[model samples]
Target: MGCTDSKDNLTPEELAIMNGELSLMYQAYQASDVDLVYRKYSNDGIININQWQNVSSKLKLAAYSAPMPPKIQKFYDSLKAENKYKLRDLLVIGIYLSTGKSIDKARLLFEAYDENDAKVLSKGDIQQMTSFIVEVAVEKTCVLIQDDDPNNVQPEEMAKFLQKLRTVKNKGKQELCKMFLGGNPALTELTMEKFVENVTMPSTVQLLTFQGVRKFIKKQEVTASKFAALTSLKKPTGPSDPKAELPKAK
Candidate 1:
């Protein structure tokens, strides 16, 4: 009838064995031996299997978005006109142009449902997704200039903001400053129109914008998991495999 501490449940020998086993398991997990981690932990209620699967999937998708090699680019350019226009095909091409990565790689960045699945991506999906990303991106830049204020950023404030971004190359930073501030001695303020007009590299802007948007999306209570699920497209079979190519133009 005596109470015993949890540690007291195990003998010294049993505790030593458990400690040693846990150490090895920790090492394996740290090393990212996913297979081993899953094999050992899957049955234990301690593992969040869905989360682990998602993390693994995202990592794989990240690899796909990496820059495409020259060979892949050349092959992509040679695809027939018809093959070039399919939704998935166009997405690959768009990603290639945007990120300089092969479609196979870029495909991982979006949702990966079966092409045959009736859940075709709508124009609304594309528009909403792109708008969400760009808005988030622009909002982030706004935050850098003025913390959470909805008012337009002043010229001097914009200049100081750009100056502080010294980590960016001098040429690029100056260009960005000029773009945002314009070249007029009398210029007093930076407007949203000027901001949009001066964005020299829309692609770069979009990419940077996507990064911020992704974080924001992930933080939203309701949309967080939904966004992740949306981006989870069916995995591309292979970059160069013809069999994996999007259906030829109708």
Candidate 2:
């Protein structure tokens, strides 16, 4: 009970590195990159973390539980303050594992790690969440375009609409135009699977059209951004689109 903290041994270098401001320290812990992880902490031949609980007891539990690289403790610690729920369950054990004790313990911890509901989270969690959102957005766009009507417009025009939809800055405006002009056929042609393969799910995908579609892109520019006059626009699907009906007399 006198002084049993494991982290108490702060080598001079560890104090200097109190972080080089590189999240790499965190990654090193994850990769088990001893060199980099060594840069961030000191082991004073004993654990003496000055925190919510006793350092030795903390390491013992972490050595037996927790998931993710032990260094993520920093991120989790920050999250604990705000998203107490997100880290409460994971960090209690994660706090222990981040110490770089033993992978065997990590594996065991993972097995029983679901001890609590996924704890809440913190602003720090946004980094990973942002990446995931981008992926989802890209995929959603692709699926929305599949099943082109094939008529009432050509595949060429359909494709142009998609290009603009992505390039445009505002989602609300893009939605308005698409609704007013009816569905863009090119988009209907792009399937969810194809979209995911060709574009970043959550990112901007540059859509290029053949010469004909390029013509459409320009035409839209000239039409004061409104749908072209009925007389100026040609049949929707060119000679394709099996389901498209014929144009009636003026």
Q: Against the true structure, whose lDDT is highest?
A: 1
Q: Model 2: C-alpha RMSD to truth?
A: 21.8
Per-prediction backbone clash count: 9, 29
Scored by TM-score, the top model is 1
Query: What TM value does model 2 have?
Result: 0.19
Worst ten-residue run, lDDT, model 2?
203-212
Instruction: For candidate 2, write residues 54-139 as lDDT tens digits.
Output: 32232332222345334434433433433232322332223222334333222222222222324322222322322222222222
lDDT (C-alpha) at residue 184 in model 2? 44
76, model 1: CA deviation in Å?
36
Candidate 2: residue 168 lDDT (0-100): 34
Candidate 1 per-residue lDDT, tens place, 145-180, comes to 222223344556554533433223233323323333
Stretches of model 2 off by over 4 angstroms after superposition: 1-78, 81-109, 116-236, 241-250
